[model samples]
Target: MSHTPTRLRVVRAAAALTAGAALFVGGPAGVALAAPPAVVAAATDHSLHLEGAPNARDVGGYETVDGKTVRTNTVFRTDALDKLTPADLAKLEGWNVKVVDDLRTVYERALQPDKLPAGATSNWYDVLGQAPITTALDLQSAYVAFIDAPGASEAFASVLRDIRETDGTVLYHCSAGKDRTGWTTAVLLTILGVDRATVNADYMLTNEYVDDSGSSISGSLMGGGVKQEWLDTSFATAEAKYGSFDNYVHQGLGLTDNDIAALKAKLLV
Candidate 1:
């Protein structure tokens, strides 16, 4: 059975529900429900239970191909930090987050800028800025642009370099923490010697953390959930353009062997 139709139907149903609810109000639905506390605690092995940003989590503890493990509390991926509560900020402070990268567009930031932890600095990278915003409506194209769009490669490269060079933990996020952030995490893990299946599993974990039904129409449609095929498009684009994922890292993202080594040294135990 083709999943495309099922996915579209789900998106359409969500859109209709959002529209119907909007008729009572003056704007689109913006009521995001956090995952249940029990569910969040269950995922505590890798997930962070932030009240404001429920999708926040560490991308660590996975054993690399060489047998070294990615260190927890060193790196995290999360959704937009705009709604972080005081308690959430305190939690992040305890985690020692030093750098928070915003992978959102200027408009998204202006609408609701990230509310960072105390002492944490923010870096803005418009990963999708070069492409028309409509591109997000097409998941495959958006994923491909995560690697090929003008300025995107540089943005992604800078994120990795920040991770490698920054002191303390570096947390990066987009609106829903699933697409741009997902690709960023995927590239970082792949470069760090994580296998394909584990990388894909990590990417798909977004569905368990976020409920995007309350997002804007475009956001809800594009980020309603993730699909493995969409993630595959990024790798396929890299392979087609650079001949290999490693080449995409070295040539496409413009990182050197020394850079990768430094990153591994910092992230691995």
Candidate 2:
């Protein structure tokens, strides 16, 4: 004979099941289930996070129209490396950064000399070589000077030549890496067939990567932070004077087709 289930036993089983469900629905696990997900910052492939150098980033990883990508570890733009620690020096050496192209003026360089890696070579190519800006009331004035200066073409040409001919990584920088340095990279990217939008975006990234609380361009002429209008002005000016960036490279900066071809060959690959 088999024993039958008691009504009391069935009722107790149902109550237990209900209590267990309630625990799972309103307990610690339940709280975790209802909580919001943690937030994570997005990573940038272009940025280099050095202790001493902010606004230091690889100009590579950008795609061109011909399906070729700018090679990483080839060209880098940064703020001053004046405060680089020994570890920072080692970091650059590990990256095989062989040449440092300083775009700062003589006075600026003297104020804060770059601390280069042991074997790395430094080239002082001031944007305004010999001729100083008379009154840098704004970034526009500075750009105007750069565009019209007698030695501007030679100076900028040297930067491109360095990038093309340097055996290893070529790192370029100014004091804050916003005005002069920004223009240099802009012209370089434009030469590599990058669109105007991408070029402008790269120039705008200085605000995100560097601190500008005390940073100023020629004593408050252009300060606070990198402005989009300033970059816009540069593009407009290039258009007005030279018709296009390609023409600007040849006529304004005096870079030849051979020079640009060499740059693409070395940096694009």
TM-score for each model = 0.81, 0.78
- Cα error, residue 210 of model 2, in Å, equals 2.2
- TM-score between model 1 and native: 0.81
Write model 2 residue lDDT over 1-269, tens digit each, in one string: 11111211101100000112222100011111111121111122566667888777777767666666666666788877888888878878877788999876665676668999878899988666444434233455566656666676677778888887777778998777777778889888888777776777787776666554554432222233467677777777777888986688888877766777777766664
For model 1, the stretches where C-alpha displacement exceeds 4 angstroms are: 1-44, 215-222
Error of 1 at 123 (Å): 0.7
Question: lDDT for every model?
Answer: 0.72, 0.65
Most accurate candidate by TM-score = 1
In candidate 2, how many Å is residue 166 off?
0.8
Error of 1 at 75 (Å): 0.6
Residue pairs that clash (backbone atoms under 3 angstroms), model 2: none
